[model samples]
Target: MPIHGNKMKKVFCYSLIFGILQLIPIRALGWGFKAHRQLNYAAVFTLPPELFKFYKPHINYITEKAVNADKRRYAFADEACRHFLDADHYEKKVPIDTIPNAWNNAVLKYSEDTLLAYGIVPWHLQRVQYQLTKAFAEKNLYLILKLSADLGHYAADLHVPLHSTENYNGQLTEQEGIHSLWESRLYELFEPNYDFFTGRASYLPNVSETIWERFAQSFAALDSVLIFEKLAGLKHPNKYSLQSNGRTNVKVYNEAFCIYYNHLLNGMIERRARASINLIGSLWYTAWVDAGQPDLSNLKEEPLKTENNDETLIQTLFQNSRIIGRKED
Candidate 1:
């Protein structure tokens, strides 16, 4: 049967709409997989020759596996709290110092349930830093790589403003989907123009204090993140458009609107991304130094004995504890 005129025109129109919809991205959590990989990839270059030599070869593993923590969120109930901390939920506008730096102290003061309910990123990161340091001390190639990749994910998460807020996805402000719009969409669009050269990594005098400081910086930027999105919405009336995801139509920020929002943000996304890169590098270097600067050039490349399954990794990392908290996407 030969279709012509109106029938052909209708088929072409429907095809075009579907094609365009495929081009738009669905919402993602925590900087998206692309940005996370890029951050881990860039951080490797910031290492000194001593550390770089060892990391250079396994850089791909680190980069590709940087999203493991994010993946663990879906498999393990306990993994979600490790990626973010809703500080405002604890005490709005309080100094970061008010929260205990040590996990034991935090558990004592806030109770384990309370800490888990809000989030435990800063605390969990410190624990992982110690684990990395121990891995370095023992010269365990497998644990070193595994812990390093996980560290990069959590450290990068701390740099996101939404990760530090109660209104992480902007459901509170009626700016839903702003999480992915800022961290994932903008980076996917403008990352080519970003400057990733953050110089060499440095040793932190105090790891715990430094982690708290980074969280504070991210929290301080939360207001700007929310406020500017609203401003961008007001400036661009057609802020959102419906796109099909093969399942159903969902609202997403318009491309032009994303550009306008990025412009209003004044390079904030890039700065934070660079910050994440630098922080990841610094933490890796710091852990190695704290572990007595092991000679990695001669360490044996032993494959990790674990099954490489999500559940296996989660059990190994978290011990399958029951996590009680609000899992913020």
Candidate 2:
């Protein structure tokens, strides 16, 4: 929880000018906080008994903290960019296949600022996998649990169709706010009836390829996400509309319209949610296996990490700052 000199400076500045950046009322709507928590909670059941035993004791922590990455967006200037990747943003000049899987290579080609400007979710997911592997090998309970929760969140983000597109919220296409409508509103409304029993975790032979493939699939689905919403709007018109609040002000959406839209999408939201649940477990198990299958039995009896006041300060600033919507999704 310790912030380095520069990050500390950023945090200090955030405290001074809290809620100064309110250009848009929208927040970066990931898979929604509840789905994230549920996905992480379900992922624990997928772990092998040996690993599951350690995680089972801390399942609540994992589930609750799954949105820490999203929360961090309020505290860190660079944090927002890590939650999404506008893959089609680069497709105009850069072929999707040509983007490097490695961080250093991507930086060399596109420059660090440019990549961060777009997103580094896939590359960052790759980086966290290594960190989780190292943490597991060393039996660092706190680090392992922390990385596991974060990895689950990032993997879920990658599966979101909006997170993979330049027109994430349909802002460019006059479908503004569609990002939250698809990712947050629909799922939150209807997810109770959806299934969560996605089977056991398995080891991934190549994490990079799998991560890239997920974003590729998400990118391909972007059109359907937009097209269906527009068609549903035409068919349903004002029937499903309702009003709500944004981070700073009022907002609106149609529940019945969303339900009908969800129906037209043919279970896409459920499929993505299910895939996230399955992939999260697989990634966690894969990291553990690659780390030589460390014994977690002893660590379960021990406390993971001690309290840190720096984290408390950062959290205070996060609450004070009303910043939202740095990246589209």
Q: Name the candidate that leads on lDDT.
A: 1
How much lDDT does candidate 1 score? 0.82
lDDT of 1 by residue, 1-329 (tens): 99899779757754553343234332224788889999999999999998999999999889978977765654467777788888998767747666878889889898998888778889889899999999999999989998999999999988898888779988888888788888877889899999999999999989988889888988988888999999998999888889887888987788889998899889999999998999999999999999999888888867655335643644443343222334333
How does candidate 2 score on lDDT? 0.80
Give the residue spans of candidate 2 off by over 4 A. 1-27, 92-95, 243-251, 300-320, 324-329
Worst 10 residues of 1 by lDDT: 316-325
- Model 2 TM-score (2 dp): 0.85
lDDT of 1 at 231: 92
Compared with the true structure, what per-residue lDDT tens digits does model 2 show for residues 129-155?
Answer: 999999999998889888998999999
Return the clash pairs for model 2, or none: 240-254
Each model's TM-score, in the order given?
Answer: 0.84, 0.85
Cα error, candidate 1, residue 291 (Å): 0.7
Root-mean-square deviation (CA) per prediction: 8.8, 6.4
- Taken over the whole model, the C-alpha lDDT of each candidate is 0.82, 0.80
